[model samples]
Every structure is written in structure tokens, then in C-alpha cells.
Target chain A: SQQGEEDPQALSIQEGENATMNCSYKTSINNLQWYRQNSGRGLVHLILIRSNEREKHSGRLRVTLDTSKKSSSLLITASRAADTASYFCATVGFYNQGGKLIFGQGTELSVKP
Target chain B: EPEVTQTPSHQVTQMGQEVILRCVPISNHLYFYWYRQILGQKVEFLVSFYNNEISEKSEIFDDQFSVERPDGSNFTLKIRSTKLEDSAMYFCASSEMGGSSNQPQHFGDGTRLSIL
Candidate 1:
């Protein structure tokens, strides 16, 4: 079963613009992580934000988690053509054992040059 | 900068036949996992392995599915009888620590399994 559901199923933007994607999960989570997948490829870890943390940043990627609302968001600043890919948000529930992740449907982002 | 690696980027098998997907996780990692994604669908967790044993598995993981470390560096997922619905991209992942540690998982490029 999937715990998260990402909003904005698809987004298109010009290079240098910013892209924001949101995710909402059903249960309390220990951590929320974001990943990117290029076409026909495996997932690439982007960043991880613990439930105790409100926000985190890595390079152009910023992730914010709100446990009270059971939602999280990913913001990619100054997007590039290479940034075109599908982004997913995965959650590890508080009671989940063995760290099994429940992933969201994902948002497909397209950046044009 | 080590990364997980998977073999046979793509595999085509007939229904009812068996298929094996292989992976070599980063050295020194302790936790291993397998996930599958059907085209246009979300990635779904199949199983998690630690201490050379299965620690967790999802409902989708049934009797037809099994995993093994096999050797020091190799992890493999075997399907006894492939079904048409079983066709999907299979990914292998590993982490430096177990789920309680909050460590992120590293994933391989994935094997595209097509059951014809």
C-alpha cells in the first residue's frame, strides 16, 4: 500500500524556474525522503527530512516536512533541463519495521531550455 | 561514492518460466531491499533483508518470490513462475544501517523484467 500521494501529477517549466511538488501521507512517519528517477531508470536519492525537522536543504533542493498535517513538499530552485525527471516522496512510518518505504505516485517535471 | 549495481539491465521471459534478478550493494552496507514498479505506477516495496534473513515483506511478496544474499557481495531475487502481471522494473537497494537508524537507502539502476 502507498502511504503518500503527490500533488501536481505533472509540471512543466523553463530553465532557471523553480518547481514545487507536494506530498501527503496517511500516518505518522519517522522520516520522509525525496527521490528522482530518470526515464526508464532507477530511483536516485535526493534528500531526507526527519519528522523532528521542519525543513532541510541540499544544493538547489529544499524539503519541508509537517508532521501535524502529514504532508511534505519538495522545491527545486533554478531548474535545468537535466532536472527533467519524475520525483517521488517516500515515507517510513513510525511503527514500520525494517525501514520498508511506502512511495507516492510521483510528480513528473519537465524543464525546457 | 559507491553505488548499488544490478545485472542484465533488461530481461525477457515467458510466462510460467523462472527468472533471477541480481544485485551487488555497496560494500559495508548492512540492510538490503527489493522494490518493483509497473510502468506508470508507483514503486512498491517487496522485501527487506538484514542479518542474512528477511526482516519484512509486503503483501505483494508471495510464495513465488524469494531473496538471497548468495555471497558476500551479491543479492538476488528469484521468481519461481513468472506471471504476466509480474512484469515490471525491479530495483535493489541498501543502506548503511537498519530502518530504526534513519539512514537513506541507495538504489541500483533496476532490471526491466518483461514477462511475455
Candidate 2:
């Protein structure tokens, strides 16, 4: 079974709209990170929020973590056509010796111009 | 800015054949990882290497999969027997800190592996 799962597998919106993607995990984690992948490309790290953190922001990206629910969310404000890519949330668990990130099935976003 | 790099932007191999995917992680990074994504699927973690040994691996990383950090610079992921199911975009990533929440990973443009 996948440790993390994202809600709403696909989303489509206009260029200026806001895009929200959510992720839920099964176990405790040390931190959660968000990544973006353009078609045929590698994942680019977006943001990392520690277990103790409630919210974080970077540029147009905003991420929130609710440990009680074992869930997290990524919000992209004023989306652009260039933002048409897949977004994934990865959880770094509490285990020692490694930073193995368990990734959620991504949310495919299509922003039409 | 230093970033991870992978060679042979793409590779195609026959079934039952052996394939070696190479990567050069960031100069100062200590942790290395291998991940893969099948067409339209999420990126899946294969293994993580630190101290020149595998620190963790997923069930998908069976006996056929192995990783090595040869020459202290290049990290490699070798699939002993290629299967059609093994075809995917293989990615390499590195991190400055080892399993610390303060640092995030830096990824490389993946090597597209196509198993025929």
C-alpha cells in the first residue's frame, strides 16, 4: 500500500485561478515536501515544512500541514499556463538512517491560457 | 548552483539484459537516492544511499536492483535483469544534510530507461 495518497487525481483551471492539491499519509513523519514535475522532466523541489511547522510559503506556493489528520496541502495562487504540470507531496517518515521520501500519486494540473 | 546530473539522457534495453544508470550528485552532498516514474505515474522511491551503503529501499527494489557510489563522485543504479515493467524515467537526487529536516533534495534531469 502507498504510504501517501493525494486527493483529486486531476485538476483543470484557467490561468488566473487558484489551484489546491491535498495529500494524506498513514504514518508519522519528520517533514513533508512538495515537488513539481513538468512533462518528461525530473521533480523540482518546491518547499519543505518540518513536522513542527504549521505553514510555509515560497513565492506563489503555499503549503500547510495538519499532523493530527496526517494531511498536507499545496496551494498555487494565480496559476499560469506554465504551471501546467504534475504536483506531488512526499513525506519523510520518522525512521532513522535514511531520508526515504514516500511520494503520493501526483495531481495533474492543466492551466489553460 | 551545484545540481545533480545523469548520463545517457535516454536508454533502451532488451529484456533479461543488464542496464547501468549513472549519476553525479552535488559536489558536497552526502546522501544519494534513486527514483523512477512509469508513464503518467507518480515518482516512486527505489533506494537511498549514504556512507557508501544502502540505508533504505522499497519493496520494489528487489534482488535485481543495486546501487553503488564508485570513485567517490559517481552514483550508479544497476538493474540486473531488465523487464518490460522496468521501463521508466530513472531519477537521481542528492541532499546536503543527511536525513535532516532543514535541507531538501536536489534532483537531476532523469535518464529515460526503456526496457524492450
Candidate 3:
């Protein structure tokens, strides 16, 4: 069964606007990672935020984790047409070995040019 | 940059047929995994392998599904008897470290399996 659930099943925005997606998980995790998938393509690793940490950033992407709420958020600073894709949040439980990841129902984002 | 690689971008097979999907993870990675995404459904974890053993697996990974690291560099997933409901996109992934570490898993372009 899926342990994480992402909010806003789909989002549509114009270029240059900021986009934010939230994910909530059911269990304690060692870390949470975000990934992006282009249409009909593989998932790309975006960023990871450990349970001990609250926020992390990479290029235009920002991820924040709140263990108290068992939720995380991904923020795209300035959206572009190329930024359109499905975003997923996966959790690695503290006891899970070999990097098994439980993924969430992804949020599909569309950036209009 | 190195990435995980999967073979036969797409495969079509009839029910009850056996199928094997192959993958070559990043050269230096030690952990490997298989996941499947049914159309319009969330991605689901199947199994994880490390040190030539099954480290973990989900309930979705039943007796019909098996994973193997037959060679030093190749990992494979096999279905003994495919079912029509098994049609989905199968993904291969690898990570340098285990769940205890903070490293992220890298995924390969999935194989679209079509069961008839």
C-alpha cells in the first residue's frame, strides 16, 4: 500500500508563477525525497530532506519537511513550461533497508507558456 | 552523469506467459529495486535487492514475482506467469546506500509491459 499522499491531484499555472505541492505520509521516515517525471518518461531525482532537517534547496527547487505533521512540501520558485511534470514524494522508513521507497500518488503540474 | 538502464522499452505478451525485465544499475551502486505503476495509479514498490539477497519486498510482490542479480552488473525481475492486470510500467532504480543513509535512488526509463 502507498504510505504517502500528495495534495492537489493536478495544478495548472502560467509561466513565472510559483508552484507548491504538499505530501503527507503515514509513518515515521528516515528521510523524504521528491522526484519529477516527464510525460512517458522516467522519474528524476529532485531533492531529499532528512527527518532531522526541516528544509532544503537545490537550484529553483525547495523542499520542506515537518515531522510533527508527517508532511512535506515542494516549491518551485519560478515555473516554466519545461517545469511541467508529475511530482512524487517518497519515504524511506527508519527500518527499511536497501533503500526501499514507498511513493505517493503524484501531483501533476502544468506550466503554460 | 551515470543512470540506471532498462532494456526493451516496451513488451507485449499474452496471459500466462513468462517475462523477464532486465536492468543495469549505476556501476557503483549496491542497492537495486523494482517498482511498477499501473495506468492512472500511484507507483508501487515491488522488491529491493542488495548483497545478492532480497533485502525487502512489499505485499504486492508475490510468489509469481522474483528478482535476481545474476551478474555483477545486471539485475532482473521475472514474472512466472503474467496476468492481464499485470500490464503496467515497470521501473528500475538503484542507490549508493541503503535506507539508513540519505542518498536518493536513481530511476531508469520504465518498461511498458502490455499483457493481452
Candidate 4:
């Protein structure tokens, strides 16, 4: 079973607008990370928020995590046409063996000019 | 600026035939992983290798899938028998922290495998 799952499988927005994508996971995790994929290409790491951290920011990306809710959200501000891509949330479970990322069904975002 | 690199950007094979997807992770990275994304589906974890052995694998990684770090720089994923359903973009990733909670894994461009 997948540990992380995203909501609103697809999202559409206009350039300069803000887009929010949500994710919910089933297990306790050490961190939650977001990734971006352009078309069928490999994933690009976006941001990672640790369990001890509630939020983080990088450029136009903002990510928030709530361990008690087992949920996280990715917000892209001032979206651009180039921001069009699929977004995925992955969970890094809290374990010593090695943290494995279980990916969620990605949300495809299309930014129209 | 270092990034993961995958060979043979695209590969086509007949069903029941064998195929190997290769990758070279970032230098100085200790952890490696393979994930696949079928058309119109979420990316799925196939396996993770560390210390020259598989530390974890998903259910989707069954008897057909195998991973190897043949040398110091190369990591390979092999499917013994190609199946049409196995067609997907396979991505190789590496991280410096060995899956520590604080680091993010870097990914390769991916190898598109088309099983005929």
C-alpha cells in the first residue's frame, strides 16, 4: 500500500495565481517531501520538511506538514506557465533501516497564461 | 550541480526478453533507489540498495526485478522477463544521507522502457 496519497488528482490555474495541493499519508514519518515531474521525465526534488519542522519555504514553493493529521500541503505562489507539471508527495518513514519514500498519486498542475 | 545519470534514455524490448537499465548516482552518495512510473499512474518505489544489498523493496518488486551495484560507480536494474505491463519510465535516485529524514534524493532523467 502506498503511504502517501495526494488530493485533487488534477489542478488547473492561470499564471500568477496560487495553487495548492494536499497530501495525506497513512503512517508516522520522519519527513515529507515534494517533487516535480515534467511530462514523463524523472522527478525533481522540491522541498523536504522534517517532522520537527512545521513549515518551510524555498523560492516560490511553500510546504507545511502536520504530523498529527498525517497530512501535508504544497503551495506554489505566483505560478508560471513553466510551473506546469505533475506534483508528488513522498513520505520518509521514521525507521533506522533506511527511510524509504512511498509516493502518492501525483497531482497534475497546468498553468495557463 | 552533480546529478544522477541514466543510460540509453529509451529502450525497446520484446515480451519475455531481458533488459537492463543503468544509472550512475552522484559521487559521494551512499544510498541508491529505483522507481517506476507507468503511464498515467503514480511513481512507485521498486527497490533501494545500500551497502551492496537491497535494504527495502515494494510488493511490486517481485521475482522479475533485481538490482545490482556491479562496480563502484554503476547501479543497474534488471528484469528477467519483459512484460508489456512493465513498460514505464524507470528513474534512478541517490541521496547523501542514506535516507536520513533531513535530506532529499536527487533523481535522474529516467529511462523509458517499452516492452513489446
Interface RMSD, one decimal, each candidate: 0.9, 1.3, 0.7, 1.4
lDDT of 2 by residue, A9-86 (tens): 999999999999999999988889999999888889999999899999999999999999999999999999999999
Badly placed stretches (over 4 Å) of model 1 are: none
> By TM-score, how accurate is candidate 4?
0.96
Using Cα atoms with residue i matched to residue i, what is each candidate's TM-score against the true structure?
0.98, 0.96, 0.98, 0.96
**Residue runs of model 2 more than 4 Å from their true location after superposition:** none
TM-score of chain A of each: 0.97, 0.96, 0.97, 0.95
Between candidates 1 and 2, which one is better according to lDDT? 1
> Candidate 2 at B91: error in angstroms?
0.8
lDDT per model vs. reference: 0.94, 0.90, 0.93, 0.90
For model 3, the stretches where C-alpha displacement exceeds 4 angstroms are none
lDDT of 3 at B28: 97
**TM-score of model 3, chain A?**
0.97
DockQ-better candidate, 3 vs 4: 3
* Candidate 2, residue A16: how far the Cα is off, in Å: 1.4
| Alpha-carbon shift of residue A68 in model 3 (angstroms) | 0.5
For each candidate, the DockQ is 0.82, 0.71, 0.91, 0.71
Which 10-residue window in model 2 chain B sums to the lowest lDDT? B96-105
* Candidate 4 chain B minimal-lDDT segment of 10 residues: B95-104
List the pairs of residues colliding in candidate 2.
none
